[model samples]
Target: MLRARRWSTRLFNLQRQGRMGTTAPIDGEEAAVVGSAAAMDPAVDWAVPQYREPVGLSRFGDRVLLHTILYHLGHPDAGAYPPDIHVFPTQISIAAQIPHAVGLAWGLRLRGEPGAVLCYFGDGATSEGDFYEAANLAGVVRAPVILLCVNNSWAISTPVRLQTAAGSIADKAAAAGIPGVRVDGNDVVAVREATAAARRRALAGEGPTLIEAVTYRMGPHTTADDPTRYVPPEELAAWAERDPIARLGTRLEQAGLWDDDRQRAAEEDADRRFDAAFDAAQATPLRDDVFIDTAYASPTPQLERQRRLLHDERSRGAG
Candidate 1:
């Protein structure tokens, strides 16, 4: 938890300093991420995470890759690594990765592989059509996928209460003929147990499971957002009482698993690592034509004209 807090602070600071393009701070959702990822076997599991899942991605040994991506959001790729090196590129569009996760799980199952795909998303994504379609397809195909919904109570400025009339996001899984569990997202132990159970069910061929981790997003949706405009100060203070990192740190300390010294060391380590990664990312060469292939193969006439103009300018400069 302390580690997560430190990284969150660093990431937020990077965003503020214009080092990172945009980032969703996970200050209050660390427990949900750490707990869920802690239950998985990294070698046999795949995690498809959204932008807000920093803690989850870190647990999967992608810390360096994460720092690299966070440092330069516009980089063409994640430093020549595989998708799951740390976490997959964070999905900006809502619920678009759901079907991809389900398809991967289905493929693995067909190959008789004993692995599960844990796809993380926010409560807002539940309202998207792909959410239902993916869940239904996973159920029908008995895909080894775990739909982990970090219901952080708000999607940008919209509260979960206003986003859905459903009693809970977990309840939606029942319609897909899969077991659904709602766990306290602030409680690391509860999240760990719930994730473990879900993985077990998937391995047993019981089909996919939906886990709705009811938590809060303590920070603004992003550096660009002014959450104060929508969220009341009192509510923010209330959520602060349930801060996931603090609560878990307290628990670990009580159990003789953590201490102030260890906490300090972890913070220092994270800071050092972040500094090194920031330097490395800044030192990396930037391709002059990196944005040239961002669009489809058949460029629009306007784009072609712009390309020709750039070429002409380069040729004249060479002359």
Candidate 2:
């Protein structure tokens, strides 16, 4: 969690410095992401995450971070993950990954693969039709999937009250004929246990589980958002008292398992790792015909002509 937080902070800083594109900060919801990811056996289980999660998904693979950096760098290869990674590329379309997760899990079952799919999305995604369709299908097919909905109180400028009238996001799981669990997202242990139970159910062929992790977004929804306009100052302050990283650090300190020196070391290591990845991403060559190359299996005559035209224009400009 410490490393994840530091990486997130560094990414945000990069965006501010105009070194990267728009990025989401995993500020207050670290536990909800890292804890749930920790419960999965990366060797077997797969992760499908929305855009905000790559930082916390180090539990799955370090390649996730490298790929994310490449993605922000506008590298075409960012869309591809190595065959063994067991993680899908980051989804920016709201709630779209939910159905993809369900499909992957169902396909795994059909192929007799022994693994479940862990899908992560935010509360804003719940409003999308994709969430409902995917959840219902998962129930009907008994897909080995876990739908983790991180309810961080606000969706962009929209608050929870405006997002839904249901008592809680977890309650929505009932329509899908699955168990709904609401866990204190600030507590890492509780989040881990909830996800573990959900994973057990999934692997046992019981079905999918919908987990609502109640937490707060202490920062803007993204680098482009201004939460101060909608998120009350007092509300942010109150949630600050329950910061997931600090809460876990305090518990670990009491157990004699953590200290300031260890925390500093973790932060420093994270900085070094991110810097190296950033440099690697920068060094990667950008493909000039990436659009034509990735858009089709074989380019049509019209596309071929356009590609040549583009190259000719570039060549003339260079000369």
| Candidate 2 structure quality by residue, lDDT tens digits, 277-309 | 888888888777888977788888899999999
Candidate 2: residue 145 lDDT (0-100): 99
Residue 94 alpha-carbon offset, candidate 2, angstroms: 0.6
Quote the positional error of residue 61 for candidate 1 in Å: 1.5
Please give, for residues 1-319, the per-residue lDDT of candidate 1 as tens digits.
6666676677678778876777677888888888998888877788887777744466677454444454446666443445545345567789998998999889988998888888999999999999999999999999989999999989998999988888999999988998889999999999999999999988888889999999998888987899989998998899899888788778888999999898888889877866766666666676776566556677778887888899899999999
Span of ten consecutive residues with least summed lDDT in model 1: 63-72
TM-score of each: 0.89, 0.97
Q: Evaluate model 1: give its lDDT.
A: 0.81
**Candidate 2 regions off by >4 Å?**
316-319
